[model samples]
Target chain A: MQIQIERIEHIVHENESVKTFFIRGVNDPRPGNYLMVWIPGSGQIPLSISSFKNDLCGFTVKRVGDTTAAMHNLRVGDLIGITGPLGTSFSIRGERILLVSGGIGIAPLLYLAIEARQMGKKVYAICGFERAEDIIFEDVLNGLLDELVITLGERTPLDVIHKLYEKRRFDHIYSCGPEPMMKRVFDFARSSQLGAEFSVERIIKCGMGICGACALPNGMRVCKEGPVFDLEDMEGVWG
Target chain B: MVDLSADIGIPLKNPLILTSGILGSSAHLLKRVASSGAGALITKSITEDPRVGHENPTVIEVSEGLILNAMGLPNPGVDIFLNELETLEAVNLPIIPSVAGYSEDEFGRVASRLEDAGFRIIELNISCPHSTALSSKKVIAQDIDKTRRVVNAVRSVTSLKLIVKLSPNVTDIVEFADVAIKAGADALSLINTIEALEVDPYVEAPVLGNVFGGQSGPSIRCIAQRKLTDIALAMWKGEIERVPLIGVGGVRTPKDVFRFLLLGADAVGIGSSILYEDLAIFEDVIEGLEQIMTDKGYDMLDEFRGKVISQILDMTI
Candidate 1:
């Protein structure tokens, strides 16, 4: 099933290497759903939907591979096949939520932060980048977040969580970043007896949940069961 | 439209079926693929006990079109799988249970239970590439005597149709195919994934946790076709009841399916392509195959079955 991109509304240069493309007329994907984007002749890749405004969706792409470089060349009115809103979403039950992201991992967490704010929940976001110039969505986060802490790579999101957990008393902590960073956060949260969930990044194919290519260590299908898994789901295995 | 239905001891709605390990995680997912247009579906290889399998990095795309995986045959065992099968009865498509075991007794026990559960077909999996990843013992498909004894043991326990899947890792696959057929296999799957290793140069380590895995995709298409051709040629010479060959390994397009059919494959399985295009690829394949048949003036599969082999034999004669 191929859904054609009706239009490209916005293409913002988030940083030196990242670009956010606003694809028009896609189904409104929840916080954790991903789109299997296909560029004719260039091949297909999985992209996390960054922003959602009714039918308009955003994909914050990092120019890291051949496919992403090819995706950067597309202009307005270009046709790109998208199949999706696939994968499990973040649970939105916590009263006070702590959101953390690093690098391109901010794509999904940014959308989640906005959705959580709109629902009248208190959202705290800890965003980290390698340097000052690498920081993205600065203005967006300032407006939606109850508290925004930006780190310039010196301190990780875990460090921020460690300092803030005693003061803020958050109901749930959610994170998506490099594996090492998330693993540290999971460890801290687990030791402190705090509920935490993190989104995993894997090689996803057939986003329709058929291909077991995205299977986790526990044999859970990331395309179907989760890209977002509760901390308990990753217990013992992470250690 | 071309009549793609096949009767390999049992009926299939089309020649394009979902290969084992592609999407056999849960019955709900299998039903989804069946409804999407797959002719039939096979479960992931199941063993007698639950398997935790290899760690993360079990699957990786090594190149543009190839994937290497060492999933280690992760399954919930037959006991739990039987429970899932109860939920799958609502699906209208034919379901074939794939069995993998460490010994002849394990194969017999699993096959016997599945037989009692009324499964129409049982695919004996002797070809998992990573079966030896945790241990030093050779996979059953790699040994002729082991293959024969395992197949015979399962055959004794079940009267249902038996399809023994073969490995492409062997020196002479046709020899093992002959032994399996003699041991009472009703059909055969041409090839499982080829044994391969991918080393990450940046880190100087094996990419898969199991150190080695199976290479699947367009890279193995011709190899599988050649193996199927060789075995079909041998079977023709031996006049061995013409057991249907289920061709697998890198079938992405209807043209690929036609190539397997020309090589004497009664049915074809789509594996790695599922990673590229998803289950809807089945519908595209069936439709593309129909269009190709219409253009080539093929109304039935029999008209084109082994047509390439016949042409080659005619030229030689």
Candidate 2:
């Protein structure tokens, strides 16, 4: 199940610290699907698909911990072992979809936005960054989305979500971001009586769901049952 | 080609058993493991009553092949778990139910129900390190009398092939193995995860939510072999009859499989290493073992199963 990395490039540099690796691999991973990128002697970590088409896929990686730092140092011709296309994909429910992304949590939602556009859905995106210069995927998102709202500085994605909610009602809210941001989104969805789902994070070992390493507070495994879960179904989570 | 199939009273496609508690909570996941080429699959340790287990961060990877977990035996209880097992009735692969309980009667009750529901091989879980969260009592496998009581209670219920799982937490694991064998266990899955703890140096707190966890993977490979050899020598001395041994802890590669077989394990149960390679590991290990056996001119599994045990004592003068 391991594939060779065909090519690699830095797709976006939001700032001095954050950069995206547009890795072209031989997998047609769907939106929300992930690949376990292995650097051999270094170690491996799960990278969510940001874009996939015709044997070319991308993983938007930010240099975070040890494994990711090693992954960031790879060149275009480097051969890395990739396993999966693992886990369930984000389920597109309605005609109008609202994507809330913050920081690197924008990775999976970006692919989801592209898919939503292909399905002829009205995709509304609220992307946030710490500074004005740190905003990424603005051009790509603008072309794919029906409406794109970029918030710079301390204005959180939740703030834009509130402003958007005051104007137009979304059929579904698909969110992935910092826990606090997702929690706020989950709370907003619950209070506003809107359908929403959130992509959660966990210490995943085997992306195939056998290992209980990625199990949530509920018995549900984040690797198998989700990296994405229906906000309403996430009972007692983040409580 | 080597005969990978084994008959430990019940039939197994190979010696690679998908050990309990990995993905045993659901029947769908069990079948997926079955399809993935595992010889057999053991369910998560289920008790008479439902257990919510511990809170988040139940399992974590400490290194490449090592894992620490204190899942506290989270299961849907026996009755609800049976619904999941019933779906597997159509699956051709062998289904072994692992039963855990606080007392002899509780273990007996669950075993009887599993037997009635048509499970042939039942693994009695007496050694879970995280069972402390379920009850204040020490692990049943740690004490000889409690282990005997539970095994005997399950033995009296039905004539199912009972595989008593032993804990590696004890000072003398062979004593517990002898007690289980004497109490009518048809087989034994030796060396459950060794009780150990890992602390976060940065935060100065235990890594596992339960504050302690069982250690598995390559770190415990030598320990598993040493314990299995010790118990095998005891069995050779007529302390207990030779039973089908399922060597469990820290098995990662084909060489480890042969090491366990040489120590008298009829089959090998892989738990933690599955986290490293996924279910694809079963196929990898099986293919590697086959190649190694062919290269060594070993035709049958019995050619090496317990071969190392003969060299353990060497009492002949």
lDDT (tens digit, per residue) of candidate 1 on B8-78: 77888898878888888676567667788988888898999988676434666666568777778888899
Q: All candidates' lDDT scores?
A: 0.81, 0.79
Q: Report candidate 2's interface RMSD in Å.
A: 10.0
- By summed lDDT, the worst window of 10 consecutive residues in model 1 chain A runs over A1-10
List the TM values for chain B, per candidate: 0.97, 0.95
Per-residue CA lDDT of candidate 1, range A1-239, in tens? 33343456778888888899888766768898787776654656778888898668998999988778988888866666666777778887688989888888889999889888889999988888888888889898898898888887677776777777777788888888898888888888788887888888887654545456566645567777788889987773485
Candidate 1 CAPRI classification by DockQ: incorrect
The residue pairs that clash in candidate 1, if any, are none
Query: Against the true chain A, what TM-score does chain A of candidate 2 give?
Result: 0.91
lDDT accuracy of residue A206 in candidate 1 = 47
Task: Give the per-residue lDDT of model 2 (tens digit) for B149-238.
Answer: 999998988888999999888899888888898998999887888777776443344545576778777788998888888888888777
Off by over 4 Å in 1: A1-221, A224-239, B134-137, B239-241
lDDT score for residue B3 of model 1: 88
Candidate 2, residue B150: lDDT = 92
